[model samples]
Target: MKPITRYLGVFVCTALSACASGAPLSSGKPFDLTPPKTMMADGIFYSQRAWPGTVPMQVAIVEIDLQTRGLSFAVSSGRASDASEYRSQTTSTFLRESGAIVAINGGYFSPVVSAEGLGQDAVGFAKSNGRVVSPASTPQTAGAAKAVVCFDRRQVQILAALACPDRFANGLAAGPLLVQDGAIKVDPKNATRHPRSILGINASGNRLWLVTIDGRQKGYSEGASFAESALILQALGAAHAINLDGGGSTALVYRDPVQGPRVLNRPIQGGVPGTERPVATHIGVFTKAKPKT
Candidate 1:
């Protein structure tokens, strides 16, 4: 795909800086849910918040309007002939190579430590541009991989893996479905916290949200549990959401017209800050060029 010629200035904000103001978290916690410092474009908003709780957390978010005329989605495609065979690349690389305005790491996969993320297989079902890149996993293999989000043009829907249709324009499976029907669905007993990547949509499914929470670094951003993640999405008004591949693989990248592509969150791979792990799949978002004024 050709890269977008029209460039937009992108800004990265820290917890201390003031940005635009939005609705506070519905939980009523002291979360500093400020609006984005700047709008990336029409229908795209970027923002960050500092949650000074028992464990401090930093979050990055990109909300896109599905109704945007030129909005489209792409999943990383591998060169392997075998659907199971997969290669990994950093989220930023996916963004640049795909010419997407926004990119985020996708579904869980077998870990591959190489810089290229080679010799890896997607842990669950994955499809790219109507091709089944990876098949669905049995519950025995990945219980969390039971939920899937399907995309067809500007329309999106979350479905159980078993309920997924035989055909879809694009889709990926990753879960422990975080939210459904405006309710949190993660196991309450599960309290494990790590850096997380989440995809969510409003009840109307016309708005899409991509979120990343930085974690594992003490005194900075400690991370969030499954419940906490769900709550954050709920606060942002997501009626349905799913957890994507996270931890060291948690990465979000944005294309700045001038700076090219850049990582939005501080990704920690192998305990090193700013390190990006190669992952099996990524979701890239593209927007059509704006009309000349």
Candidate 2:
């Protein structure tokens, strides 16, 4: 079920129907591996999963073509108290202010890997003039003004959380994590999703690598592990990739399948909720560069 097809179904009814209509047989099923078309525009690339599935929460993954431009990532809490606010914070506010297009949910939490820091040990070092200074002394202290910014650089970035005590103790302790450059396959004793095979794939014709957590979630019945999702992204030609926020918060929005640009994925808790928690980040897609006019 391609996203375009599923999104087409949503426009005809309330967005909630998109999820309710699918949950009967698809609540626990994963998407099939049928590669979908990809397009690039306005410094961003857009692509949807080949198969259709309900996310049951708010989330998205977007790749900001930062090959020649600078980029940054941050998380914030809003007054509206819903997932849409988080998406707007990244797309309309954070990204707009900094001119960064790509964003995702959930900031990577770690001592050295906070949204405001460098790599675990700086193996593939890149120069940066501006620093992502901490907005608060602690994560609990972060507020609406809190954010993380990445200085100008040309590398497939990795945003991940440490699942173990020594997730990145040494330069190579991060695990079998796939980055935009390549796969840093590391074995961990405290594997969070141990016994579950993950899928890995290189995107952007192998320029980006995308990894996903909670592959066994409903829409990913075909996905039993993160590795499986990686393969999906790889088949899509991601050069380097990493997992974003998944589970109940995994939502994807796109243009209307039958019409035009519209919300493509279902992102709500049980299809109803007063206010959703503030997501750390989000992902938004746009067209590739425009022709000279």
Candidate 3:
């Protein structure tokens, strides 16, 4: 996928500085819940809020009924040669185009490197609908990732990569698991706050959450750290959760009966008309159209 505007580098640089000398972490509390709004449809629900009194943070959450809807992974380009054609788009483009009810960016991989199956794509693995769309090799280094999360549409699981089963109906391997069994799992060293996108599933495996927290904008939202994200998910009822490709790549889109398709969060990067940064993959929730009666 393509990189975002120049400020992204600055965002990272500033993040380091702030991490070293920022105020104490947020108190574990429920979201402030102002401007309360929600949307509900067949097997889906959406809501948003802004946490205040600190540095202000914006977050959007979508809950999908896995039993009534479908959950799967998608990529802009399916073939190696067509890689350039489908590199990036706003999360909504993938959602609206794929007709998904809920969606978020998937996994981490350099498009150019992955296109040739060279670096992580050569090592990291992704599979969609029972086929090995991306291959895997030795994990390069131990603890390269804190956790590996995958799903088979019917169920999603989190664990060490070595313990992850061989294949799935559709899945992605990306993490630093934010919440496990409803407990926060952030390492103190990785506790820096930044805009974050996270995915979570309930113990029942029948409900899923797609979340995004906006950051890097002063007086608007400063973002969330790995621990904050975990607390947020747990507050929303996630028994298991994982952080996905975040930073400027964080994006969330929802379709409304009246608003149609809209980007619910203010994506920090090239999210202008026809300019959402491209990403390696996407996770989406869709429902099978019932046969006509």
Number of the predicted model whose lDDT against the real structure is largest: 1
Local lDDT at 122 for model 1: 82
The residue-level lDDT of candidate 2 at 147 comes to 23
The CA root-mean-square deviation of candidate 3, after full C-alpha superposition on the true structure, stands at 9.5
Cα lDDT for residue 51, model 3? 62
lDDT of 1 by residue, 85-131 (tens): 57778888888888988899998888667578466888778888877
Q: Give the runs in model 1 whose Cα sits over 4 Å from its true position.
A: 1-30, 82-84, 290-293
- In candidate 1, what residue range of length 10 has the lowest lDDT sum? 1-10
Error of 3 at 137 (Å): 4.9
User: What digit string (tens of lDDT, one per residue) describes model 2 on residues 31-88?
Assistant: 4323232333334333334334333211123334445343322233222433222222
Clashing pairs in 1: 20-35
Return whichever of 1 and 3 wins on TM-score. Answer: 1
Error of 2 at 248 (Å): 2.9
Which segments of candidate 3 are over 4 A away from where they belong? 1-25, 32-37, 69-77, 80-86, 111-123, 141-146, 162-167, 189-191, 257-260, 270-275, 289-293
What are the Cα lDDT values of the candidates?
0.79, 0.30, 0.61
